[model samples]
Target: MNSRTPRPPHGSSRAGPPPRPGRRTFGAVCAAVGALVLAAPGCGVLSPGSNGQTSDDITVTSTMIREGEAIPARFTCKGEGVSPPLRWSGLPDETESLAIIVDDPESVGGAAVHWVLYGLDPENPELPEGTVPQNGKQGQNSKEQAAYDPPCPSGDTAHEFRFTVYALKADIALPDGAPLDQALGAVASNTLARGRLIATGGR
Candidate 1:
């Protein structure tokens, strides 16, 4: 006098529920970030790069490349060999000038300075792509030339390049085409704040 339900299924082929729409895969997240980077491609302080310690207010960025990303060949010897668009922000009010250094620490001899620029207008925080320094003067690089020596890594893998900006109390007084060491020393002495962006390049 009791009623019971019977089951007909064994090892059913029915599918589980679809993945949650709210969840994001690693590749999806990276693609989204890369798209954001591509959308912004000129010299303006859009966002911060890989300089992790946020305690420092100053930041440097390049619209051409993101942190740990490949620098465009147009900015390297393989292409047009011009400087990429760069910008910065978070300078203190006392800042009278700014400086920039692009170098490769993984050089054959030692740290190879690629490009050096100082005496930038602190109030202005943009260096347009392929543009030469206006108020600031360019300095010598590892190649012993006072110009942007684009990255030319010989190996299969790309080399890390650093683009550092220094907020200075006053303009660096070194003569144009001054030695890299002297220019670097001047920046270090007068720097009030600093930030950097690391990029990659290869032949």
Candidate 2:
């Protein structure tokens, strides 16, 4: 997808002023920010602080693809490039909201964030194919677009895409179109538990 990538139905156009030229690549942005992104204060590079939460604490599943399997082309840049369906359970009883971030940390250009989404309803455990939950909010991806930029890894080797979910103590109050860094920081801070469902995709 080019710069004109269309927003998913759940995406918002209200993100702050469009990203400045040359600031399109997330890796560049992280480098420019020094240790901010690396420290989990800005970028979603590090998973939210678990505060004792463990990956085995929650169970994330998806009918579109199995754990560690290759993501189907239908949900990648090779095909429709739509968001895949996801389901999760085992949230803490105190969980009040949820967040999901899909990213490729091994991207040649640095860690490329394909999607930044938050404010999901804690009670809702499933997201249908190509869609976000009704209450979910969309945060700008590394390209500064608030949509799913389907993975299109270069070369023959597949790229690992982390579909991580965070169970938060409360719903985030970020505005629609918030930057990825801001949204991720909020999610990380409020996270009560977290889990991941890894999948791969490539040319």
Best by TM-score: 2
Point out the worst 10-residue segment of candidate 2 by lDDT: 1-10
lDDT of 1 by residue, 67-183 (tens): 988777788878987788888988877778788877765544444667777877765677777665546677766565667777776566557787877777777888778865567
Q: Which stretches of candidate 2 lie over 4 Å from their true place?
A: 1-23, 28-44, 48-56
Let me know the TM-score candidate 1 reaches against the reference structure.
0.69
Off by over 4 Å in 1: 1-55
What lDDT tens digits, residue by residue, belong to model 2 across residues 63-162? 9889988878887888988888888998888887788888887666567778878887766677778776556778888877777778886667557888
TM, every model = 0.69, 0.78
Clash-forming residue pairs, model 1: none
The ten-residue window of minimal lDDT in model 1 covers 37-46
